[model samples]
Target: MTNQATTLPESFRELEPYVADWALPTRQERYDMRLSKTIDELGEFYDAIAPRAEEAIGYLNELDLNDLPDDATRLLHLLYSMVLVSYPVNVFKQPRIPDSGAAFFDTVAEPSV
Candidate 1:
């Protein structure tokens, strides 16, 4: 167990360093966070999380998405943020949308579960 209160499952403690920055609740927030970081920064997060994604999904698969514990909920958000940043890290090699000036996405309704 970690000395600080655990924000993620014990097995995923290695990801704690990213929780403060990457664990976002809404899709738009995750997207905005992606736009805020440099490609290198996004790549760093991608490299760290990609290898553990399947494991994280497997662990989360056992839980109820609708009523996850606080730790699991945060983990879910981290996954969401990872997805948001992936395009920039893997394809675009840029933070903002390409060839779309002032274009932005506003999430009207976040997923229920």
Candidate 2:
């Protein structure tokens, strides 16, 4: 694999170091970091990136999925995982606001039958 960093959207540049070719963490590594960590504890990472969530999704959506390189494919899967878990569907009626008053919001998923 190339040692060069994968190009990412401006909004995702902060993650460049973490996702660099030689330093990319495995799915298990990412999960291990989150074990027993509260959202409050993890806010530093997400709070900064949450604003760009939509843009990231848009960029991913525009990609030709079938033709992505290994690095790009891995990054795509990582972003999808981030998006899926960050927004709880059935657990809450509305997006929860932090005690610090940051107004992060996401669409509430419809009730499941």
Candidate 3:
């Protein structure tokens, strides 16, 4: 496949620093380390990219959900995941840890096609 980075939307540019590698994993892989970021790091990342989130979502909303290209599909999924996770859902509450222990953890699974 061509470098997916070249095809990403401008709204997604801010996320490049954190998610440059957007690799889709194989069935054998349960999680992708590339998506890992500490809570504070994620907060910073969100702060940087939050401005574009709406535009990204608007672009996604304009797409024909039934017939999106692989890249567009991936972007839509990534954007959707970001919106969902950003909401303060008590059901998905994270555990508290010491500042020293605040480091990126590998847990995000690759988006399923």
Candidate 4:
């Protein structure tokens, strides 16, 4: 898919009226988070999933989420703001493919269709 950014229409974590029932970080708090400052850490997180994210939009060719659970996919989509971060693609997609087998650790299945 095109390199479009990802976003939720209405977060279950941010539901109004019942918003308090779900614990979510304030928008300012989320923006201020240091872990979100750079693309590297976010990419690192995505890199960890690069290998098995096929079937999902994060698959190398397109933004498919056929691999992870819906909850996990939604969480990652929110954090990275895209289907796949470039970190893994830049660092591990080629020169490190062999050792990068570790990328598949803790792989989770996508929610059933």
Candidate 5:
């Protein structure tokens, strides 16, 4: 959504390009998305977001978790997605788990932000 880029806080607007695909709301969604993309795509996202992660976390820490602004909530989701992709980018070097054919994780519930 173009609106996501415009709506994100100015400091993180550079990451807006990824919001549409990566700002998912659940663990399962994020995990599935990681598997769907190629390693190169995951690396692209990792390279862009990893450097700013601490800063983003610091920014989020300042806000009230119970009442985060919509932009902040989206940013948090983006961060979660980053976590899901890091494994493939750093270790496996592949989108899906190595040699885990047809196996997937099914989460009954995800922690609320």
Candidate 6:
């Protein structure tokens, strides 16, 4: 978990010791972290949407989710927004996420590559 938290270059200072805990995990570990982040987000409303939801049908109206359609590629990001931003953003124009109780962040670095 800590390893996953350090991947952000911006948070390097805060994560430095966390990073040094191990030489570094492999590139595949990096990819897994990204994938896990997507999966972790599913918990936010998974119970409500899992077998399915009316909003899922509505947002996807005239579209087929089960079909290996074009938009299916974005299934995770779309779900992330629906859970993290879209649904709440609709009711109020503000951004409010429960976890982190709020996010405090800093853009500390920019990649040369």
Local distance difference test values of all predictions, in order:
0.85, 0.48, 0.49, 0.36, 0.88, 0.35
User: Can you tell me which runs of candidate 5 are displaced by over 4 Å?
Assistant: 1-5
By lDDT, the best candidate is 5
Off by over 4 Å in 1: 1-5
Query: For each candidate, what TM-score against the reference?
Result: 0.91, 0.47, 0.50, 0.26, 0.91, 0.23
User: Higher-TM-score candidate among 4 and 5?
Assistant: 5
Ranked by TM-score, top first: 1, 5, 3, 2, 4, 6
Candidate 2 per-residue lDDT, tens place, 61-88, comes to 7777667655555556556435533643
Better of 1 and 5 by lDDT: 5
Model 2 is weakest, by summed lDDT over 10 consecutive residues, at: 89-98
Which stretches in model 3 have alpha-carbon errors above 4 Å? Answer: 1-5, 20-36, 87-113
- The sequence of per-residue lDDT tens digits that candidate 5 reaches over residues 2-113 is 4453656779988888888998889988887887899999999999999989999999999999999989998999999888898899999999879999887699976787
User: Least accurate stretch of 10 residues (summed lDDT) in model 4?
Assistant: 15-24
Clashing pairs in 1: none
Question: Which stretches of candidate 4 lie above 4 Å from their native place?
Answer: 1-35, 38-40, 58-84, 87-113
Whole-model lDDT for model 6 versus the true structure?
A: 0.35
Error of 3 at 60 (Å): 1.5
What are the per-residue Cα lDDT tens digits for candidate 3 across 1-113?
23445445554654555444332233222123213544454455446556777777788778887787765665655554454335322222332232526474554564445
Candidate 6 lDDT, 1-110, residue by residue in tens: 44444432322223223232222223233223323443334343343333343544455455554553433323323333334433333443333333545454443553
Candidate 2 — which residues are off by over 4 angstroms? 1-7, 17-26, 36-41, 74-78, 84-113
Model 5: weakest 10-residue lDDT segment is: 1-10
Model 3 steric clash pairs: none
Predicted candidate 4 versus true structure: per-residue lDDT over 14-107, tens digit per residue: 2122112111233333223322335555454444444433533333233355665445444444443323334334654422234655463332
lDDT of 3 at 39: 49
Residue pairs in candidate 6 whose N, alpha carbon or C atoms collide under 3 angstroms: none
